[model samples]
Target: MVYENGKAWEKIVKWFGYKLHLIVDATYELPIMYSLTKASESDIKEGHRMLERMEEKQAEILKRAETMVANRGYDDTKLIIKCWDKYRIKPVNDIRNLWRDGEKTRLLTNYKNVAYNYKGNVYCYCPETGT
Candidate 1:
């Protein structure tokens, strides 16, 4: 797998933030997976590159496994391979505190305060829109 990150490890340490790129193959009962750290690179920049690298690596692994399986020829066993991608981001802020009642949910607390929330509210001014 390929890991992509800018030179922002210091910021990540200070703010308790992390970014990850993960791939999983779950077709079989015993899943196979790979993951890598991506500190602060944009998804658009790293997405395609990471996927391509993972595909190549997974193909090699599968070929090796296939050869082994053919040699052994295990009985009544199935080999199903799957590949998928995942990404995660954590901003350095307590979102629960930003809420009205400040009641933290189980998902929020479990994720180390790193989950997106969409309560019943709307914002007229969106920073991304610059409106």
Candidate 2:
């Protein structure tokens, strides 16, 4: 797997090795926390563990955070809800298109005009244009 963020790129090719999950303060461009795990470990699982650890030990830092930025690898529904409901921190993570059956957009419940794409981007359908 290749984790690409603009100019910085991290490639995970080795089968038998350790993976380092590091959380950084983006404003300062400094690392705040880290976790080392086996290469087989899932990013979502590690992400939950990291959040738990932060809540238990360094909650002050978590409280200061307004948003948590992550890649699609960490785009689990539960994790996203947890970040918002528990800490009130908005998650700015990339979403993966998990839609099967060639779904393009899903209409929002209770809102006739509003619909969202697989990426969670909301849009309004025009009745006149039939769009």
> Which candidate comes out best when scored by TM-score?
2
Worst 10 residues of 2 by lDDT: 1-10
Clashing pairs in 2: none
Total clashing pairs in model 1:
0
- Candidate 1 least-lDDT 10 residues: 71-80
TM-score for each predicted model, relative to the true structure: 0.27, 0.67
Q: Please report how far candidate 2 places residue 42 from its true position, in Å.
A: 1.0
Global lDDT for candidate 2?
0.91
Q: Summarize candidate 1's per-residue lDDT along 3-105 as a digit string, tens digits.
A: 3654433322433445564433334546354335445444333444554564566656443332111111111111111211121111122122345655433
**Model 2 alpha-carbon miss at residue 107, Å:** 12
Quick one: best lDDT, which candidate? 2
